[model samples]
Target chain A: MRFFRQVWVVAAKDLRAEFRTKEAINASFAFALVILLMFSFAFDLPVETTREISGGLLWIVFAFAGTLVLNRSFARELPNDCLDALIAAPISGAALFLGKALANYVLVLAVELVSLPVFSIFNNVSVTAQFWELMLVLALGTWGLTVIGTIFSALTVNIRLREVMLPMLTYPILVPALMGAMQLTSALVAGKPIGADNEAWLKMLIGFDVVYTAVSLVLVETVLVG
Target chain B: MINKILYVLGIAALAILVWNIYTIARLPEETRQGEVFKIIFFHVPMAITAMICAAVSLVASVLFLLTRNFKFDALAVAVTEVGLAFLAGNLITGSIWGREIWGIWWAWDARLTSALVCWLLYAGYLMLRRAIEEPTQRATFAAVFSIFAFIDVPIVIFSIKWWRTQHPQPVFWAGGSFPPDWTTHFLWNMLAMALLGAVMMSVRLRQEEAQRELDSLRRMAHAL
Candidate 1:
């Protein structure tokens, strides 16, 4: 009970701070829009080809632009020595990690939400045709990214060149999940029927999210307080 | 004493490797792919040795976290570095084999892609170590990250396999009537590569320990 509250408290703290400043939120959305625009320019493909490949493009944008939100999750805590203070507080490291990850999830999801409409508009695909299934994929995929990106954000928080280090460390480990997400997203965007293969990819995504989140929760104490 | 053991192991590995090379030279060309199939002798063993080194490094990383022993941390680094080299060797040999047999230097096969991803993951691990200054903190963070990385390995292999598999299935031992001596030769090659990996790890471990000592001495000098 208390643990849940603690997680919520930490999450709410980030939300409040981020809302007040709107720094990471605004920047990530802008970056996401820019990426979408560039994709249009980079490939003036036929509408059919765009629909076929837009899933890959959407997640590429999410993965690249999502880093903006994640990179700041822990880095923001550094300026005021807030991370150390958080560690010194009565909160468990797992709670702290979950809190930050939740906040990141919301922030990244917001960027994705906005980007989806723009992506559909630009690429002439109908996200509304498969909104619920698309949301499920986005939520699971983004959660996988947030869990990984958040832990790596903590891991690289104190390192020099952390912005670069965070993605390098995070991306390779993210390959499996990214592949699963990319395949599923591309299919859903193309209005294809979800088959056994898509089912497997979805399960893989769920397994990735659960396993990574559990491992991060268990190891967060050692990583943060050590 | 350790140096003497390593010396013997080094000599044995060299002798076995030389003998294996001679034996491979005399072996009949494959009935199908001709002499190119012989590369499997090196390719398979290097892949096996690299996997073993990665497993050992994973254990060392866990042990370091459990015991807070810097020696385990050094072992983790040493074995991973050596493993990365062997993995690179495996990839290069496999590429050469693929080009000869499949007419392409690369394929998005499950095995090849996962191996490449594994290489990148460990490379990132070493890079993470370089970016940290405090020894304990560095080890802790690396160990934590290594655990996650190792866990991700199976997911990577399975995901890629499920996503799409194009790599050829094992053909050497699939009831094909090959000379029985080839099995012995494979075992000998495996032994040689394992010993070579071990020796390389020991040498790197010593360097890591020496580097730690120098770091501490430098800090002491700064304080004085």
Candidate 2:
């Protein structure tokens, strides 16, 4: 009961701050849009190639922008000694981590929702028919990304060169999740039924999320306290 | 005393490695591969050495996480550094061989691609450690990531086999049988290479222990 209240407090605090500033969301959305435009110009305007590559391009854009958001989420907490107060509160470390992860998930999802339509428009691909499946993949992939990224961001927030090091350290470990997400997205864009490939990717995503979350939860206290 | 023993063993290992290189140089040039086949003696052993080092680091990481002992963390970092060195060797030698044999420096072949991924993953692990200021946090995070990243090793090992089954097989796996004459020498050199790798890791681990002791003394002096 107390843990839930603590989680709600932290989550509400983050969401309210994000709502007020809109700094992270705006920057991420803009960054992703620019990437889509760059992709349009770099690849010849052939519809087939555009459709085939858009899924991967979209994910890469989100990943790059999402790093900024995750970094800011923690950076915001650090200033004015907010993180010290949070640490002093009677919250389980796992609850604190989950709350931050949930907030980041919502922010990442908002960026993706806005970017998806723009991606379709620029790449000349139709996502209207596969909206629900694409949403599912995006949700799962973003959840995995946020869960892993939140923990790592917090772990590295205290370090020097953190802004640069966070992505370098996080991206390689996130490869399996990224690969799974890209495969699912590509299949949906190509109109393949979510069969074996989807199943394989979904399983890999779930496994990655569970393993990293469990390990991060166990180790977060160590990282935070030390 | 230990240094003297290590020096002797190190010299003996160097001698054996040189002899192995000489034997490979003397082998008749293959009709098809020409001189490029010589790379196998170096490239294959380097990969095997990296794998051995990675496996050792994996064990050390798990033990460190379980025990929360700092020594195991040192062991993990030490082995990973050695592994990265050998991985570098593998990549360079493989590239040279590829240039001579395939007429290109890189082909995005499954083995080569996976080797690159493995290299990047461990490099990230090392960078993560360096990024953190606190020793305990560094060790904890590094131990966790090392174990997680190691899941890619088996995937790399089997990728060529799986990709061959799905796509057209590469020349290396086409026959699916070891050339009989090459097998004995290859296995012998591989065994010696593995032993040399183990020896190198043991030496490095001892050096890490000394460094850690030195660090502790420095901290103590500062506290005073």
* Isolated chain B TM-score per model: 0.92, 0.89
Candidate 1, residues A111-176: lDDT per residue as tens digits? 999999999898777876666888899999999999999999998999878999988998888887
**Fnat, 2 decimals, each candidate:** 0.87, 0.65
Question: Residue B98 in candidate 2 has what lDDT?
Answer: 73
* Candidate 1 docking DockQ: 0.81
Give, for candidate 1 chain A, the lowest lDDT window spanning 10 residues.
A123-132
TM-score per prediction, in order, is 0.96, 0.87
Give residue A130's lDDT in candidate 2 (0 to 100). 72
Q: Return the interface RMSD of the candidates, in order shown, one decimal each.
A: 1.1, 2.3
Query: Pairing residues by index, what is the TM-score of model 1?
Result: 0.96
Docking class of 1: high
Q: For residue A31, what is the lDDT in candidate 2?
A: 90
Q: Report the number of backbone clashes for model 1.
A: 0
